[model samples]
Target chain A: MAHSTTLEPTATPATYTDAPRTGTWDGGNEPFKASYGKLMMWFFLLSDAFTFGAFLTAYGMIRHKHGVFTGTAKQFYFSTAHWPIPEKVFNAFPGLHGDLPLAFVALMTMILIFSSVTMVLAVEAGHRMDKADVQKWLLWTILFGSMFLSSQAWEWSHFIGGHEEGTRMADGTLMFGANLAMNQYGPPLFGDLFFFITGFHGTHVFSGVCLLVWCFIATTNGTFEKRGHYEMVEKIGLYWHFVDLVWVFVFTFFYLV
Target chain B: MSAHAAEAEHAYVPGEIAKPNTAWIWKTFWVLVAITALEFVIAFTLTSPDWRTFRNSIFIVLTILKAFFIVGEFMHLKHEVKSLIWTVLVPTSLLIWLVVALVTEGSFIGEVLSHMFT
Candidate 1:
């Protein structure tokens, strides 16, 4: 090969701006200072929030229409009106025969909140580079998350199974437990909304647990240690906390209000 | 990796706890519990139809407060940069508006339709 003594660069000069080495679209050096992973997670949560908001809003709209009417379609405007009391509907609790309004869900709420605390602790330990503490707290978190899911399952079964004896309608037709098309609960929309909203939230919890378990296994295998950061834990913590946060709203919209 | 390089790369002091005291976490937990308990009490004791609207408003307010705690503290959004906080919080506020608009408009439509049909 013959070597040329004079060097000539023929390529056009690449244009440059103040943009980051990584494309601005990729969120490099953004003011938020959050990693791409974290930023994307936030975006996802934001969209998910809208999904939930839309569902709840639709429920509220339908409920407002049907919830207040008591009489048949002919004299609907002249009928006495009341929404089905949520506390009354969800009164049953495990290991108790009598009515205990909101107690079961209350316990479920506490369990979820406690799990959030564990998640925070796990993130804290991650920051401290304490592998064992992260493992332990993550384990507790997984336990609590599992407990929440199981309780939700039990609640769903109980709700679907219908504990309330058939309520007699004006035409003397009997209504049983909740179904998409019908429900003993005041309005058909109520059961439908309950199943849809809670089921959606339950799916999030389920996925959150799966993510937690993934983190737990990776932590046990020292993946984070090698990476020299526990950002994974923090990222997962955001998701877990988000799930808990959504439940707070659900608890209020469905159970309390 | 060399010890010095490893230390520099990690940038965390091993065995040193981050936010060592967990009192804040516990405090938030108690606040959540208290709010939930109060919600229960109100649900059971406030039976009058006149209070239904007011009770619902209270439930919403309390729920928002609890949500603030969970997102602000547990998720550590409160401690994040001002821009990041706003980035999240501003959009979320729009959701509340979305709910309000949809509910109010939907209810009004329902009321008009029901009355018109009747």
Candidate 2:
């Protein structure tokens, strides 16, 4: 009767006869203090991280099995005998010709990072319930996400099209472009990993863009305004940031390292 | 249900909602940009075969550093409850074992392949 008298409605209802309710884990309060949707987003991101980690790990193993080309940067050239240097392979920039290694990918990295900044700003505006600011920042985030996707498209086309002089295959015929079958870049595995990893990452960016568009529309429609909370923007913002986080690793392992 | 009780049912407790901090956001943006630029500089200058291992180590270290900021600040994971932070981070730490095992095994395979191919 003493415990029953002290029982608060906010606490989980007493079920056991003897056990005292600790209140934290009594099933009434959220232990993490996060809404279900937000916590689910974090878990989803965690699983997505493993998916990427597995791909990159496999790539590293295969790359190690095929020794890298250790010659000087000037001496480096595409060959089937060894792993090609990433800089030499990814050297092209749209509109600009010649060997400016990593410049274009660097530009893409900047674009992704900038978009992430905009996404957080949108979330911040949402916190204040500033619908207009949320829409504006969300628009910038979408624009940057699209720019990043376009940059990737150009990079992929360049990769698939190959260079002026293609690598000579084992059959003594010159092979231009890259496919799952072969590549001008080095081992066939090189092209395969490049396509799979970056393509998977690109798909994520595309989806993030689509989600942002939906969030933008919802803001325009004053849906969050009616709900009196902008948690939807926060949820999408988590996904957008996770995409950017994946890009950081992709940029490192695929390009820099 | 009475209005007061209904409101109480859904209310966020103190510190549940973070304050809007624009300045901190910009500061994090600059930090991310600076780290990325540094990575580019190292990539270009440290191109010699001799520095390959050392340079790669630096890149990985910097990458993890950047990851901290992106996940902690941008994702707002740092501001979340302690249990939530650990739930996300503790499981991710398992990736270290996967990277080590596979890469070491890959080198051994590389040794075997070299003999066969040659």
Candidate 3:
């Protein structure tokens, strides 16, 4: 509701005390010494961490429920009775044949990390008010991020396409690739969790890329220059780093563990 | 505008941005890469079933180590005020409890499923 009293402009815009607060809890100052936007970004990231944590924890539970596979890698086969080894499922690589194990995913991880580095570089450039450097680093970050997404797309396709032979289900029908309902992998839940968790992370990456583009545009437009601060770059840098951090965990739990 | 409103709008002046540390950023990147490489090596080498627990634990520890660098250096959390650091980290520690409780319950259900279906 609009308040007429508050909305009306006063003759003198009353100035507040510029004196330093005596205590951290004194209501007038930023106790954390961070801008409101930065603090909120941290909080948002914290909340997002919990969301991913819940997903991974649920993944761990479902994985534990399915039980670990005891057979050697070579001896392992697609079956609903036992959980499939991650390496076995994710072995395919682009333009290569045979089992490459965790190679492709590792490449994806590196791409994301590199992008994160570029993002931080961009943020650093922003702090110096170097518009050229900011645009340069942001471009690199966006490039690397797009590379990661493309790699993920390839991985997902390879996963969904399955091998030509395919695995025979209990009912004698041959199943190819993976979907929410059934997969040639092990249990249906395996395919389901893989898609959901990684898909969620992928969505975050996609959005992060879009944000980087926006930051790049703003940098070119001299928006932050006019504002006398590049805090916007820092905020988006936080988000980009958060995405990379989530991938580190995902790499471990989803693939390695 | 009223004094309260004026104060509200102008009270929060942001502090100066910290100086950039390019060297630290590169060092952190190398550290992350090294840790990830180690993970891959372990995954490829430790294939036996008996080593599963040990391997998983190592992976978890290494992942946490990587997380420290990413959050601390890349996200610049380590440079923030102490209160901000605690606020971000304290709430995250609850995930440990969540993991323990849910995972324990999961194992029990898993045992039931294995018995029922097999």
The C-alpha RMSD of each candidate to the native structure, in angstroms, is 6.8, 7.9, 7.0
Q: Which residue segments of model 3 deviate by more than 4 Å?
A: A1-8, A11-26, B1-21
DockQ, cand. 1: 0.42
* Chain A TM-scores in order: 0.84, 0.90, 0.91
Q: List model 1 lDDT by residue over A12-111, tens digit each.
A: 5565434446766764546876788988888888889888888888877776765463333233221113457676678788778987878899899999
For model 1, which pairs clash? none
Interface RMSD of every predicted model, in angstroms: 4.2, 3.2, 4.0
Which CAPRI quality tier does the interface of model 3 achieve?
Answer: acceptable
Q: For candidate 1, what is the DockQ-based docking class?
A: acceptable
Q: What is candidate 2's DockQ?
A: 0.46
Candidate 2 lDDT, A1-257, residue by residue in tens: 44676656565545755566667667667888889999999999999999999999999899898977877888988888899998889889889878899999999999999999999999877776777789999999999999999999999999999988998888999999899999998999999999999999999999999999999999999999789888999899999999999999999999989
DockQ of each: 0.42, 0.46, 0.44
B-chain TM-score for every candidate: 0.80, 0.80, 0.79
Looking at the true structure's interface, with contacts defined as alpha carbon pairs within 8 Å between chains A and B, what fraction does model 3 recover? 0.85
Number of the predicted model whose DockQ against the real structure is largest: 2
Rank by lDDT (best first): 2, 3, 1
